[model samples]
Target: MALMTTRPWKHPKTGIYYLRRAVPADLLARVGKREEKISLGTKDPVRAKGLHASALLELEQRWANLRCGAASLSEREAHELAAPLSAWWFDQHRDEPSQQTFWRTDLGDGLWPRRPPGWSLRPAVGAALIEEAADSSVHARCAMEDWCSEQADALLKRRGLVVDETDRRKLARAVAAVMQRASLALHAAMRGEAVDVGQTLVVRPAMPTSAMATPPAEMAQNSLLPISLTALVEAWWREAERTGKAASTHEAYAHAFRLLVAFLGHDNAHRVTKHDIVRFKDHRLASRKRNGDLVSATTVKNSDLAALKAVFGWALDNGRIIENPALGVTVAKAAKVKLREREFTAEEARTLLRAASDLTPGRELPQTYAAKHWIPWVLAFTGARVGEIAQLRRQDLRRETVAGYPEGVWVLRITPEAGTVKTKQAREVPLHPQLVELGFPAFVEGGRGERLFIVPDVKGQIAGPLQGVKNRLSEFARHHVIDPGVSPNHSWRHRFRTVATEAGVSGNVIDALCGWSAKSVGERYGSVSLKARTDAIMRLPRIEV
Candidate 1:
């Protein structure tokens, strides 16, 4: 899959967001343009993001409609399309008793309040008469009908549905009926009778499938039938969750599946075949990144193929399918080349640490300040993954007395309890003596939140706020490091090993402290005690800024 540059573009002059997309080659002729652009009308990034998503959804739906052309609409399809109209009407009028007359008399043919003829001669009465005339039942109904028609037209355009005049009239009639139903419900509310006015009317325009609501086993029995992609992914996710698959991983895989479905132009998972997978692979490989570089083979294999294979395998095991469409698909391996050492050099490490230490307060969030300042130092000493250090909590940092030091050592606990751990196992690394001298303990004690680096509200969302911090940190590091060959945050792990070895720390003890997997069965038999780990950590020298 290609990287998407679908985020809202901000204008340089006005600071307002805009939607910018190039029209597909085939679509250009039909759309009559090379590209489509729309102002999002908001300077606020959050609002712009929401508006952009909605606008993008409608654009995709419109393009899809153009591709398929107009189709015959069944009565059921018309009714389904019009269902939200009723809920919308009910919500708008549920609390207004004055609006009852419009619903009670077919928009007030006999119920309109009349303006006295002689009273119109007086100026005050003339203004009053005009106001009454404007508020009459006939005008109210006309406005209501026009609004409904406009909504129905927009809905049809958004869904890319085209209908003949007769079918369009049929839809208009369906809208009227639904609106009447809403009116009746409103009347019930007025009469102090029970009504379901709180009905949520989210409009989802997905491919219709009978197998969507069926159990996986039942779906397998009718394997030839179409099953919706949404249903398949939901079921897959439920099982995946049970097995302790990371939610962020699921989010990425599910997004990949959606992209596949979009490329396929349908959501039928059952209809997908090996040929489709191969064609998708070819298409993905031919696709390019935003910078015009060809999408990496590694990305296609790891993200797209990996997701498809896992989901399809789950489907097969659950009896939803007899075969996995993604089976045997693989990307050819490229030779691993060592351009330079993956570890940071002494100068590069010092450069990053110095910049971090210089970051002052009040520029960003408290957690961000902590991340920018101490996270580098923590990673440098502990040799932990950047994410592990970024997600550390106040409770995870504790003082414990171990051998060789009755004064106690400050241990940073790397555990899944805080967030995700690659090994699914927890371990503790004693803080380096250099960190203690740098007032790392005072910094940890200063924080008042649950997390030492990440904010509490965003801690639950693995892919949202935490990912934002990671991206920002990467950007911040790259600005100083200026090395495209090495990863900004991850190079610390490599450098730590090098430094530890030079300091004469044992390999197994280094692995344990760094949370690496045991090399052999014997190595796994005995645990690395805090005392031994403390001794090892004490041996390693710290980076001097």
Candidate 2:
């Protein structure tokens, strides 16, 4: 008898190799199948092996997408995918452009010296109304920004549709392309090469050559728009919130924008061009901090320039502006100040855990010590982040029966409901026996609060409690754990990783327990059972002061 294998299973009738792997029982409910099969399209053993690997990867990705609530394209989505391509094609062959140029009689749309082939192929739009619009002088008199907006409005009316920012750019680009060729016709007409077509009177371009100077009156007209820098920042913030961006991201953008508004006068976004932004960038690079102190170039990039990029990019894409002022601007990457990884020594970890076990509540410790005490211990043992441990709720502590495990497991569910996870993936970290032995489970069982940790908050406010806990933890670390090399609460996580690795735990298991995705293809197929994680965790030496 041969050992059963789940490689490429060959069909008896067709002699074609088909990759066959039994889908995990847990995923079967969501996947709606017990097993997944993909034809390898080959009978050769080596070729089948290669094909099987590729097919299996795609299947796994599909399953992952399913778990993440991303489904295959719907009817509307599939059409949208093809819509851009078809629209691009339509603009490529739009025949009414030369006709419009005939009506314009202006160099901007007139026949050009360097016009691409098929310049004359555009079918003339005989509709006098469209021709009247094409020849409208209202835009040519206005500022370029207003002209562009008017043109966009005209485009929408012409197409009988409203479009998103993506389509607006496409139309803008197409309009510019048409204008380029037509502008050349001005040169042709000036050089006495103007051709006579029916109803086409050669029009001259308004823009003058070197010999011709623009009028002083036209130059004196103000280009300053009334839309302020504050407006753009506010809109970006609203969009960020609407799109479900993380709270921390909103805070960072807010801080940076405040610095920009303060320094740059919070004037009109339209009034600020590339030149204005360059000054702001230069000022920061030369150590003009918002606090008026010298900071590194890296700080400028992370805060000021990066925030502007997000703001200007959003404004451009949302059709709030014709172009992004911050498009090509950047603070060049500079060498960063190197800092050591914060990790406590083994002995220090033991001491910290012991002190957290102090049951006495005082002015310094308070009643919240129940949670504050366990936070460091949990982080030290689990290597979970401070943010993750601090945000745990009463319901998150679980002892549940899992499939394939004879005995149930005690696991802490770290998720986003109470607070945010850095990776966004919720993971189960098996509770260490040492923590259980230290009455951690009993403490949790006794808790009646909605939150695992108690932090002060103001009504209708979100950041108060979270920020409070973090500040308190930092103070605790500074006072108790006096190490120049290690940070307080965060050092506990680093120490856990250090000890876990030293104790010969596999990297993947540690990553799994810490809410990290698999780094390898094969690792994706198998489950990291609670028993395996529990066993691996038990391998660590118990902390002792």
Candidate 3:
């Protein structure tokens, strides 16, 4: 007697097996039953078990789809979802020869002919059009046609597709044929011409192959047809941001996928596989930045692969791809990033200040070279991150008095209200007397915009402009800051710490001054008054440039 294990159920009558899982009451109606079960359809337990596992995996995915909706751009699902309506939309409006067009010359009444009003009112033409329209919008139906055409063109360009006038016509006709049938399905369904469910829809043929990477025979499977990788990425990114992911998180994810799409020969994402993912992982590990150091696998895993994984997982759950190419991929965890201990020695700081001064012209407009010229000096004295300094609103630098203190201090508030920050916790740093002495206040007053810095919004819908400032700061460091061990904008904080330490400033005072969070309860309690920190910072030496 074959016995059923807890995981797989056995049917005693036929000695076959079935896999069963309970459906939640909430999903019972959607799934259409109390428990979901699928017969293994084999007598051999081993074969049945394999089938059982596969079936179980698929069932779980189906349930997930019920919960989250389709999210991928896989060939079969795209075809099933898009081809019918898009084809109809295109067929209803494609260009044709004047002599023998199908609707005009071949069919007596033409597509959507002026059928009898009563005839259309029945559950046939009018009802079918209404039903189809209800399922998808006119805009969506029309957009899919354009989307397919673009997909074809992208593949054609990538494959180096060459075609004569005749071949091009055939390609057009081939795609048109799919759309024609798609239109036909809607018409037939409405007109009572459909004999069954299969007749109510048409199977779309493979996309035009002349420009496809794979040949016709190889492209025979509908799933093998390409969905535009970049298109999918753009769509996914837009949706991701819309659905309330943080702007920074969405940008990070988009950056990775854009790189992936560029690296993978810019093909349909469906064409990529686990093998391609491995190659991408290896390439990232072996790759070097402009500074020529091998990139860390951890970065690839966290930023690149992590983003790709979320996207691919969405695609997989939604049925765009049958399997996630990024699944089961692993990268070694990165050790904590240690900033080099180097800082600006006194002479180097003086040299950078002199160089910065030369870059600032007489005009102090925020948009001018003069304002950009002031950014480094601002970072140097404030010990603020370059981005923090660059993204400041004029109002960020304000005079405020502490509750217990009698004297007012000029403070620079680093907060996300003005721009993005690494630490969400807002803090106030004292404006070094040097900045005030150099007429920083007068320069800001001259600026036209609310922003203190002139970096344009290179960041699109998903990124912050401060990223540009950060990169420029790095470039500025490469030339002006000039020490390999010290990252340019970053070294400012290290140098500030150096000065603070020499002035006998306590660790708690440095933490409060530099926006570092409390590391321990003692440190949290040890935070000194703002005036005390300002006084500590003021003790540092200033040089004449």
Candidate 4:
């Protein structure tokens, strides 16, 4: 038969009893009726008495279950409780060896699987235990350990807690001591604020940290930068201000700098020597236009070299570099003087004028078709730049009467306020009666205030002045095939200048009508009476639309 027993012991200091268990080895080894016990390890008399009573109650219940044959030994229960039983046995024999040595021996043997019943008496458990174990000194020590040196100094200064160097030194030492005591990882702990991390404290590289950082010097020297290119461009902008460039010039410089920075990242700027500029020039020559056609090397060389001169000039002035690298680079000369000038022949102008009057089949009439149709005719007859024509307002036109003239003539006063003229001076251009017959009256009558031309319809129903005019002219030029080389807009102006020069118009008189000033003659000859110039412009023959 297997049997079970309980032993009681009590603590001398606390008078607490702990139950100790013991089981017969023969019964434990057997399959049936295996025995187990609970041990109370203390030896105090009062606790021992309580332990004895508790053991009696437990034994009574076990005996009743055994007698009824409802309780039987389980192999798993025996195996599971073996370690706890071994541990209890060792505690009972602890006096034979040092307590630490005995505990180590039991642990090494894999004993103590089950928790001790007296574990509930630990100081971390009950409210009374916590109260009795609380250490004010350690709590203060932990509080002091949380302070960061820099943050503590800032806080003390902000709160007026530091009165002098002594106070600062005292706080600094306190912060250092706290940091040392806390044993924090310096980098990790410094990442956050006093209470939590904020964006201002987030560490990032001082250099270009984006994909759009300045590009290679060659690429940047060739292309425009996107608007999003930030840090380096912004730094350059600040530097530009320090250099005292004119506000408008600085603004233009900033715009160009941003474009360059976005194309080439900031890191490449340092490497951009004079040699790099030469390579960049070659690259631009090889590059294609937005239209997918390869740009002429001469055209690329001319435009980009001029722009580079401006950029390097600004860079030198601002101390971005010590010298202009673009010095001696030259572009191929324009071949226009050798090439015959292409102008609209009288027959071609008539054909274009007729084409402009009627709408092409299957296409809606252009919004500025009326203005664009007649505007080109006027340019061909009067020799005005497209910009000068576009800038004309209804109020600028006047009816002039000269003493020798039989009738009043319609004239346009080209104002300097409109925009830059060829001569950088204002002049009057006469409107031919033939232009009036071709629907100039209706065009002028339809507009309000200073606006002369109607806005043209564009894709997405958007309308504007010059864009619409160019679009319509491009369409007409494509339809007629009138000198495939001649752009509809440029051909008209060329025709007027060619005709006036061939007709023996004085260059100065022609220049006055065209709002051009002779640089040699200077501004003294640039300004002329609006009426006299208007009369000179009227003598030119007009082609009917």
What are the TM-scores, per candidate, against the unseen true structure?
A: 0.57, 0.51, 0.57, 0.47
Model 2 residue 375 CA deviation in Å: 1.4
What is the Å distance of residue 305 in model 3 from its true position?
Answer: 2.9
RMSD of each: 16.3, 21.2, 15.4, 34.5
Residue 436 deviation, candidate 1, in Å? 2.3
| Model 4 vs. true fold: TM | 0.47
Model 2 C-alpha lDDT per residue in residues 360-422, reported as the tens digit of each score: 677653435665687878887788887787777788888978555467667898887666777
| Candidate 3 worst ten-residue window by lDDT | 96-105
Number of clashes recorded per candidate: 0, 6, 7, 23
Candidate 1 regions exceeding 4 Å error are 1-226, 261-266, 282-295, 361-363, 456-459
Clashes of 1: 0
Across 238-324, the per-residue lDDT of candidate 3 in tens digits comes to 767566465677677777776777778766675677788889888888889777878867789888888878877655433344346
lDDT on C-alpha atoms for all candidate structures: 0.73, 0.59, 0.60, 0.48
**Maximum-lDDT candidate:** 1
- Per-residue CA lDDT of model 1 for 172-261, tens digit only, reads 666666656677677777788877555533343231111112223432333322356666787889878888987667777887788889
Pick out the ten consecutive residues of candidate 4 with the lowest summed lDDT.
205-214
